[model samples]
Structure formats: structure tokens, C-alpha cells
Target: MNLAENTLANADFMIEEIKKKLRMATGSALKATKLNDEQYEDLKDIYEMVAGKTQFSISEIEAITTELGRLRKA
Candidate 1:
């Protein structure tokens, strides 16, 4: 759970945590394996932002989901 490392496992951890914290309705669509490793830093940024807060506006969730979508592997 040492997310400071940029490993695939860390990416998976961050993705799962983000999904849980966001209570994403389409969580299944955002699996860690589907994400691009090159975008790990971006994902980490999102994860940190999400983790620091307990609440989110509808628009904020949508925006984060969208950003995650953009980071998905093609």
C-alpha cells in the first residue's frame, strides 16, 4: 500500500481506492488493468485528490471519472 512507488500494484491499489471513495456507479468499467501505465502519475494525482476528501459534488465525480477514462489503455 506504499503508493509512493510507481508500480503496477500501486496503480491498482490507487484505482481501487479511488473507485471505493468515489462510490463510482460504473466501477467495473474502471479496472486497473485497463489503465495505461504511462498515466500512473495522473492517476496518482486523482487518487490523492479523492483520498483527501470525504465528499464530492456530482460534477466533481463526473470530472474525475472522465479523467480516469482518458487514462485507460486504448
Candidate 2:
């Protein structure tokens, strides 16, 4: 494949990895917190930020990481 294709493939791989992490974290957090409204809202926001309304992108993954950092501090 060409350079652009290679880069896109790598990005896709990373996005999938991030999605897995998000799924596990969100599920564990919800289970531990018992799906409280606040926690659910947080997870929903994270999911939306990471995955967007229709699709996931590299920028959205970066935004998700940034939001996770903020959440960690809070």
C-alpha cells in the first residue's frame, strides 16, 4: 500500500484499540458505580466524544483522551 493508506490503516488500528479501552473502562465504571445517573451521563459523554454521532475519527480519539484526563482529575 501507499503511504497514505498505511497511515490510515495505522490510525484505524489505534482507533479500534482506543474503542476497546473505552468500552472496558465504561463498563467497569458503570458496574462499580451501579449506573448512577451522573456516571451514565459521563459515560455517554465520553462515548459520544470518542465515537461521534455516526463514526469515530482520530481527532475524536484525541478528544476522548483529553476528556479522560479531565475526568481523572475530577
Candidate 3:
């Protein structure tokens, strides 16, 4: 997937990757459809940050998840 393009497929890819990297227990709740075009860049930024790291502290995971929550569509 060419994530450089801001498409929904790319967004879905990033969201799934982020969930795996973070080992999010509630990942199912964070669906790609919940992400909108307005939040794509923010999600991309989060995805990049998560991708660059191999491990995360509980606090870091919480913070990242919280940020994602803020970006989710209501």
C-alpha cells in the first residue's frame, strides 16, 4: 500500500498497523471508518511514530491511544 497517498485504504492500513504495534485490546473499537479526511495527517503522524518504534511503555500507549481517540469521528 502506498501510504504516501491520503486514501481511505491507506488510512485503513495505518489504523490496522497502529493497532498491532500498540497491542491495543480495544482495537476493534477503533475502526478505519471512524477516521476522516481531516484526521488523516494526524493519523499518519501517529502511524509513523508507532512504526519507528519496537516497544512502548504503558503510558506511551495510553497517550497514543488517547490521541487517536481525539481524532476519531463522532
lDDT tens digits, residues 1-74, model 1? 68777887888788888988988666666666665656877888999999999899999988998888778634
Stretches of candidate 1 off by over 4 Å are 34-37
TM-score for all models, in order of appearance: 0.82, 0.38, 0.86
Which structure among the candidates has the greatest TM-score? Answer: 3
lDDT accuracy of residue 68 in candidate 1: 87
Instruction: After superposing candidate 2 on the true structure, give the runs of residues whose Cα lies further than 4 Å from its correct spot.
Output: 1-40, 48-55
Q: What's the ranking of the predictions by lDDT, best on top?
A: 3, 1, 2
Report lDDT (Cα) of residue 28, candidate 1.
67
lDDT of each: 0.81, 0.45, 0.84
Per-candidate clashes, comma-separated: 0, 0, 0
The residue-level lDDT of candidate 2 at 7 comes to: 43
Q: List the residue pairs that clash in candidate 1.
A: none
Query: What pairs collide in candidate 3?
Result: none
* TM-score, cand. 1: 0.82
Question: lDDT value for candidate 1?
Answer: 0.81
Write the number of the candidate with greater TM-score, choosing between 1 and 3. 3
Cα deviation in Å at residue 49, candidate 3? 0.1
